[model samples]
Target: MNTIHTHFRLSYKIYDEAFALSQAAQCHLYLSLSQKAIRFAVVDTARNKFVVLEDYELITVFTPLQVAEQLRLIAQENALLQVQNWKLVRVAVSNQQFTLVPETLYDPVHQFDYLRLHADLNPLQHEVYTYRHSGLEAINIFAVESGVRLALQGVFENQPLQLVHQTSALIRSILHVVPRNNLRSMYAFVERSYLTLLVVGPAGLEFCNVFHYTSPEDFIYYILFVMEEQKMNPEQETITLWGDITHDSSLFNILQKYVRQIKLGKKPEDVEYSYKFHDMFDHRYFELYSLHLCE
Candidate 1:
């Protein structure tokens, strides 16, 4: 129940007293998958509350195929993931193979073309997918590994499933929680060694991109670089942090040294969480929890 494979370790888990396998028909399942980790959350739609959450950390880097194999093992062993009667299922893929295009200009036939500008495509290993963000008036064109996509589909064969990029979920949840008073700000969503940065203003989303870093220096460098390019004054503007970081962590410490106003982001305000979730960091599992906001 704790480890799916030798590499996939159950970092933590939380379950509400109200959660029951028999009530899956009234619940929604959200999954976040990446080379570094895989996590999932279950929400009871009837009460608009999260009932269960689990985080699995990969001890070492995994190829898409390896991740798929671990996911298969997880599906076979995890009781919650085995249920197919859920009201909704959404899986968010966290990776660098994604780009955003204006909704007005998006063409279904050219999804591949749009993504090619940002990432190389391998038909044998990757599959192209797109998600429309109505609130932001944009289309997120992304690639998911064929192996991972197939594994997810096979697990939920009897139910409808929506696959989205991790950024989509982050954007939806951040927009919902960030004050919309026309104040521009920066937000960071951290994962293993990957960092996703977003700049929002009165008009809407200004800039969004992801970076891969190996050290705290690399992490802070990207933030400063983006802020300069976006004409944001780090001294005056606020930068909010979420996912895989702590106030005392090296990442946070390095960021605080350069940015004048840095704060930790909270969970999405629109949804409710069970009391059991209070013990976990509110900013962690943000992308997974925000899957509820994805259409």
Candidate 2:
């Protein structure tokens, strides 16, 4: 019997000529799941280089089950995602239901308590989880929708897998490339309706949080609010942006109006990328690419 499957829109995709389905066992699979999109990338562990990347923009989905359905459709059509023989599978869930706790104060037994302080959680629908940042000595407390979590677990039932929040991945990636000068800098991971802002300094990750905005004004307002709260000067401090934004974008225009040093971040340099990805924007897919850096 032929089952009809509706697929999400593919926003961007790149594959190296050397990539092959037969090499799944020798590579790592990274999936970044969010309310508005699901992006996945493949890395050739043998050479420590990225070989495949695909981004799918999902239709508006309100429930966890609806997001799971969209994921299933994309997996059914994606040859790379259908394989279960990857050397490692890491999934990063992107949402606002997350918080950062200092390592010394983190209590695994109280994961729910740590996260509930920052966001409300529906025990039946959302599962609280924690990812330890070894380098920064912190614990990331976040929630994942049960349906989506179950769907991914079912997909790679026997394969080695790890799950983390998208903000965790972004923080890991940002710290990896934080300037040697150790200057306090603001990093913004922009999405369609939200952005994850992080302030990293010489000591390590100082602040991390997600903000939802509807317009350009709302976007800059949050940026400036964070700056004022952190005592960062708009005319002197630098803010580097990444993810779903461009130089000519209205969001960028508004950002430049207030911030003096506005820079577009590049992909992580710690890992290599296939030449096919050379033409792609460096700042885009910062979370998806950073999954490779996650344990």
Candidate 3:
């Protein structure tokens, strides 16, 4: 199947050329893969800013082989001839089978068994990966099909790259920007077909889950349900949103009806961005941009 590729050049000059030649350049390549699409970014760590960003949508869900081919195509098209010295390369997968476990209760020896109990995946067929939250004393455990991991690894076999599961990246992004004093606040990272709801309270991360919705009603149902379950009053609690949603979108409009303090999330305050990024919606690429901040 042919991949539909869209490239957006924010800078007037080709940043890759300068990135390739500059010995002082601290460049990192980041990728986020989902069932339906792939998003990639190149960040100049020396400047603490993004230089190039692109999004590619597959015509249909991709098989492992197809994804590998696309990755190879991306590497070639981007002209990344010298990836050996890259500051870092990271990839995050957007799969839903993930669970968070308290740090004290987590054991590496039984990691697979613990995850299998909560997520329905064959232990033999999937590879388990864990990420620890910096601020909270909890661990995020998730799995990806072994084939998918191998395919992604094979693409960068010659280079040093790290693979991160989506749950970790999502949680990391929220932790980086979510206000610490906000005793009652909910964050919804809205995507095209799914939304990740995170509830934070005085104790810590109170609730975290991903819900798939086909309509506006379904979307609001999950949001309101989380609020109700978490004892968060919509009239007083704030709902901060990020990802592919806009103020004029139906999803946002429906959410406005029930939530009084609805606001769009901004990029992490620690990172710097070029003037070119101002043209795009700040909330649209939270995950992709947050990859730079992920440890």
lDDT of 1 by residue, 28-140 (tens): 99999988888999999999999899888876655878788788878888998899898988999989999999989999999998999999898788899999999878999
Number of the top candidate by lDDT? 1
Candidate 2: worst 10 consecutive residues by lDDT?
2-11
Per-residue lDDT tens digits of candidate 3, residues 91-111? 887777788888999898888
Better of 1 and 3 by lDDT: 1
Per residue, candidate 2 scores C-alpha lDDT tens digits across 78-139 of 78877979999999988899888889998789989888888989899998888999988888
Residue 236 lDDT (model 3): 87
Off by over 4 Å in 3: 1-25, 62-69, 81-84
Q: Predict model 2's lDDT versus the native.
A: 0.88
TM-score of each: 0.96, 0.96, 0.87
lDDT of each: 0.89, 0.88, 0.75
Q: What's the residue-level lDDT of 50 in candidate 2?
A: 95
- For every candidate structure, what is the RMSD over all alpha carbons to the true structure, in angstroms? 2.4, 1.9, 3.6
